[model samples]
Target: MILWSARWKSRIGASTIRGMTESSTQKDYLFKTIGVIGVGLLGGSIAAAARQRNLVETILGAGRNPSRMRAAQQSGLLDRGTTNIAETAAQSDLVIVCTPVNHIVQFIQTVAKNSRAGTIITDVGSTKQQICEQLKGTLPAEVTFVASHPLAGSEKSGYEFSDQNLFQDRPCVITPDESVPAEAVSRVRQFWEALGMHVLQTTPVKHDLILAETSHLPHVVASALAATLATENFRYTSTGFRDTTRIAGGDPTLWIEILLSNRDAIVTSLEKYTQSLQQFKEAILNNDEKQLRQLLEDGKKKHDTLNSAP
Candidate 1:
């Protein structure tokens, strides 16, 4: 079982109480040391944000590349760096796996095997269902694994482009199943809150489905839009064109893993999107002004609502 400090109990009663206390408290270094596996953009940003906010006394980084690890250390993003996953997992109070989605389960298993009892583990994988399902009964009983996905990051990749404020005011979804301890859930939620994220709770399946439409679909659309524009057409492009295709610049390898991991949901979303496009095209071909106007108006209203939402 995980043990919480008296301060944690005194501060954590209701969600409202937790928020009030966290905002009022001077220091909230819940973890003594945090181990971040795969210290690239997402991982490096987490380390930088934690250090900037004084959320952890030490941030230990581990990656597959020794040179990248050394560079992360030299960049002031890590107190210590290594290529050994188990060693770092064993030493830290909390371990956050930031590796690619395909490798998340392997890292989680390694962490569980090496980490001490009561250590908390989490990941930043974009999709959750597969990881959560694979880890169902695999982790040590005493070790807590909370699946998390932060809705932040730009089209950019690598630690060089990472920002300490990357997660500030951004949404982070935590998908904890019934098997996870309540205390563990609370700790993970508080950890993300400390990093300046708006925490939301949902199930792994729901997270993947929702993100498939809202995130993955957009990336696909953006890439498709960019692909149609010839290099010679660059001079004709405007801000609207640039804005619509910005995410197309995201790392193709990373996106391929994400798309493949959530293939079912993404494909469903794509089918629906394709139907909508067909409807729009048909309206244009028929010169149905009313239908085109109504479609455009509906889109405008939905976009406006999203912009106005908190």
Candidate 2:
């Protein structure tokens, strides 16, 4: 509610994230033309990665801003750039919707309308339930969908901050219901794997719940922690504080949609986190050395796992 972090601005998907990881191999062109909608960090990085690995024949970018699209095209990240959503969809064999959670369902519908038969469409959205459920039975019979979320991003936005290696060694989740074809799912998987991602598969419901804790909940906690300081205390902050609150710098507009779409799961995560926090507080308040040490040890043990995470 408090729009405090946009000033410092500059982030998703992590989840029981079980998946198969294949090593980077000889890059073969995966698709004829790949269309990317909303060429922000993830989208731009996808475009960049495809180009760097020569994964596609052509990369087309779409956005509301014509100038920005044109700039991305000029940078060679996109072979074509336009404000025309239908054109991008029609020309693409694979369409990657990189828009925010709220816009994805509607926007992909527009894309599906204009796409040719057998066009494979995927997304890098934060939440999967709303999008996957809403589009479940709705996409044109000719178009195929495999909802996905790549668990890597920066607190930065835009094409300039995007790196071709952004998806490298990171988990890229794919959520496909039973109706989607195995061939279609493989097509989406091949695309991400070519970009150096370790592919993960899960139900949309599971993806939503898992990411709410690993991704959405952290953003919420980061924002809450960042908002505690007064402007006068800004100069007193240091690297540790900035690192802890780095995600708080993400675009609020994008995150609000994520928070709302995954409301129930995020609330559950918040409840769990708060319960843990209360224990820490009680331990400190009572100056209970044994309890404090145990709590700290538990947190350390859990956090250390991140060091070995793939």
User: Which candidate leads in lDDT?
Assistant: 1
Could you tell me the lDDT of residue 56 within candidate 2? Answer: 71
Candidate 1 C-alpha error for residue 240, in Å: 0.9
Per-residue lDDT tens digits for candidate 1, residues 236-289, read 999999999999999999999999999999999999999999989999999999
Error of 2 at 144 (Å): 0.5
In model 2, how large is the Cα lDDT of residue 157?
Answer: 91
Per-residue CA lDDT of model 2 for 117-137, tens digit only, reads 989999999899999888878
Poorest lDDT segment (10 consecutive residues) of candidate 2: 7-16
The 10-residue segment with the lowest total lDDT in model 1 = 1-10
**Where is model 1 more than 4 Å wrong at Cα?**
1-28
Candidate 2 ranges with C-alpha deviation above 4 Å: 1-28
lDDT of each: 0.87, 0.86
The per-prediction tally of clashing pairs is 0, 0
Q: What is the lDDT of candidate 2?
A: 0.86
